[model samples]
Target: MAQNLDDNYKIAYDNKAGFGKSPALVLIDFADAYFDPGCVLYAGVDDALASALRIREVAHDKGIPVILTEVTYQPGGRNGGRFFEKAKPLSCFVKGQKTAGFAEGLVPRDDEIIVSKQYPSAFFGTSLASTLTAMGIDNVVLTGLTTSGCVRASCVDSMSHGFITTVVRDACGDRHPAPHEANLFDMNAKYADVVSEAEIIAFFRSLKGEAHG
Candidate 1:
């Protein structure tokens, strides 16, 4: 899978470039605890799950901190309406599961940070902002599902928070391709550096080499 290898390379490069430098890698996952099955967002559930896992692997290899943001199932919460209507079946499956309903391929190492959130924006009502600031992070590279939703929300706020945000375009996807493309264009124009995986990887590799030399 040359494509997979290239994707991994870009992720690793981003990690290296941001490593011990100005930017920090913030990996967000739309784990099972975060979504309802019947929700329209769940249409590409498998792809979302796969992408999270792939990025997690890349981040771990580079020693970048990965934050797994878990969303609590609140019936009346921001996504509650969607949960009850479109995502009800998915929600039921997750609720019935015995273990913590994380997406597949989510095995963060001991050093990674895991955050449990309740909203679309990862920094909302969370310590993400402070954490990033404390770590001297000025740029944020984001990857995750439903590009039109959580990914977009986080990108917008990351920029507002004064972080040069980059959304790894190939690393993210949506249930439908149209919305995914539209939102990415909008975010790139107004909020983030929506670059391809290869470009990000090149940038990261250069940064990492600079640090060591």
Candidate 2:
């Protein structure tokens, strides 16, 4: 008999890239576009954002660096390139649109960093990787909207850039459960260690006194 999917993948993809000594929490593209019911890009991902907020609180208390990402484009999406042309829904992110703003209660602190991009990966054409490396962050804990899009893209780039990447499953959302679950499974198997919010919170609490907010 053929092994189950999980059992079959366990043979080769079960290895874990555990948390490292230095870490940062990167919140990717949690914009109003995904939360606003009237918007075409609305994903009904409020629960995911709620879970991320909980993680953010603990991360701040633990003094772990928190980074936020946003997608933006100039008038008519002139800067979005082929991605904009391919996905008409990206028009919601045109500069100055309220839908493009960070979701409710997801504001960036004065000391936090915010990256703006026109592509899927937060690291693509952005200073995220360099900034994290400069600050000596060895592990990355990710939380964001659309697991199959920007979140997955950033996860791959995070590992490619040599960080111990971790994806908080409960804190990332997608338009549908199929892609969400599929991407999480693949990411856990090949790129990042897909974990839960509780696990991440426990890990953060364990790092007490290691850094300062």
Compared with the true structure, all predictions reach lDDT values of 0.64, 0.93
lDDT: worst 10-residue window of model 2: 1-10
Give model 2 RMSD, 1 decimal: 1.3
Clashing pairs in 1: 13-204, 37-90, 37-91, 38-86, 38-87, 39-86, 39-87
Q: Estimate each model's TM-score.
A: 0.71, 0.97
Looking at candidate 1, the ten consecutive residues that score lowest on lDDT are: 91-100
- lDDT by residue (1-213, candidate 1, tens digit) is 968865774565433222225556565655553355644335455654555456555555555556666555544344445544564433432333422255656666677677766556788878998998877677788877668877898888888998888888876767788898888867866677777666655555555432211
What lDDT score goes with residue 178 in model 1?
88
Error of 1 at 71 (Å): 1.3
Which segments of model 2 are wrong by more than 4 Å?
Answer: 1-3, 210-213
* Candidate 2 C-alpha error for residue 109, in Å: 0.9
Name the TM-score of candidate 1. Answer: 0.71
